[model samples]
Target: MAAAQNTPGQHRGMDWCGFAGFRASKAPMQAYAAELGATMQLQVQMPRRQPAPADIVEEYTYTRHFVAIDDPVRLLEILPGLPADKNHTYEIILKDKPCKLCVDFDGTDGLPACFASKQDFTSRVQDVLTDIFLTEFGVQLPAESFVWVFTDYPVKFRAHLVEHHIMPDGRILCLPQHNPTHATRRRQALLQQAGAGHA
Candidate 1:
């Protein structure tokens, strides 16, 4: 049997939004960090019941990603009392201009875990970052450069269509008709055709 697809509300009361599939130039990180000094920070929390083994500790440094922890202070208090052989989790915080973004490694590689209260999950941090780079640092990125995905479990993503498509005959087609309404119509037509074929 096929596994159930993950969607929002599957986990009951938890929804996450973040960006993926966007590649930014290395210049942004360098420029931001130069201006802000340590634009990113690594937060490590040692295990509670037992200390992390040497290999796990080494892995933390190598992977450069950490599990999300609620209270770092509480974890620190227990850290001093536990043995030195348990595993710890890690979290990376990126200090983007005007917003402190938390990077969650699960579901997608380095998805910024921005809650819906501030904005919908469809919002892309990459767009904001791209704007900052262009306005502040004079760096320009292509349109629709960031893809945002929001979900409750497993994981699914939605991205904008590229500006142009290349045909098999080597013809290049500009995609001005790539809006949501066109996509919905295309999907409905495909479904209707499939249903008729099945009949």
Candidate 2:
């Protein structure tokens, strides 16, 4: 059987409220909680975790015509402390006229000791974030965006949608949210179209 998922308090007081509760004199988890809060505030533009798996299944149907954001570094940063062997991936796709970001982390090599430790995880995550910001957005090292982190087992991936920037003609600045498979299909289609028109 899989190792037990950490309890809400397993991280030692880092609960869902985004604050670490104090049991006594120790406040070890407080620093991490503050860092996490700041990270969420700067990176995740939207608040709250994505719909649960059960809720997603009950409410939505997976479709094509979506976009995919394949940023391995971003994935690493968002899920700080995951084992190196545990590879994580996030897919933002088009579903129901909105973009949804889905995250999953698997044992690429093999699962190491549950994250190694939170501090190490957080530092590594920050490094990943730095790289992602510089390379993708071509902005500074720590540019902020609308990304959120969820608390899923193995890892969590979160997203906030771009809702307000809609046009009267029904045009969307962001693409739809679908699975990575669909995104791959879309990419191939785009490449094929581009190739066909070559002189």
Candidate 3:
């Protein structure tokens, strides 16, 4: 059952709709690293306000190479699944030597899983991205670094910041604006497809 309702902004932990959040500074990641030793790096940039709000907010990119794993498809199937409201997009390149996976995620239909505002979320995500690249790929993120990764063919995560300007009327517009008709059709299609498949 969908549990009892609570605050609108408060997400239920088990619902699978929240964010991965700051994985470091906690156990598991910390615990795993204790045994793994210094394999990664994490860096951050101080926030700077623009004379006028700009579309470009945050960006990250990383690349690494791994021993030709026996099966790359299996490796990809295991990465955490993205929420329906959100979508993760990337390219998997397999060449003669090693294999590489490049992936990134945008804010999607809702606000980021962490931070109070989009700006805060952008900064935090950038920090996490740098940390992952440093630790996973053994690379360092430089300020104005532009790019945080450079490795053989393995796995890479990258992101960019795009924005929608707020009108002088004090209205902010974002993607995935609610459309009741669209929602209803999507739900009905799901039901019909389920029924047809079952038959």
Which model scores highest in TM-score? Answer: 2
Q: Could you tell me every candidate's TM-score relative to the true structure?
A: 0.19, 0.25, 0.22
Q: Which residue segments of model 2 deviate by more than 4 Å?
A: 1-102, 106-111, 141-178, 182-199
- Candidate 1, residue 193: the lDDT equals 35
TM-score of model 2 (CA atoms): 0.25
- Tens-digit lDDT string for candidate 3 (28-117): 333333554634312121123333223322211111111112244633542344333323333332333222212223223343333465
Pick the winner on TM-score between candidates 1 and 3.
3
lDDT of 1 at 183: 47
The order of the candidates by TM-score, greatest first, is 2, 3, 1
Candidate 3, poorest ten consecutive residues by summed lDDT: 59-68
lDDT of 1 at 59: 21
Q: Which pairs in model 3 have colliding backbones?
A: 40-134, 40-135, 41-134, 41-135, 65-153
RMSD of candidates 1 onward, in order: 19.8, 18.5, 24.6
lDDT of 3 at 150: 16
**Candidate 3 local Cα displacement, residue 53, angstroms:** 25
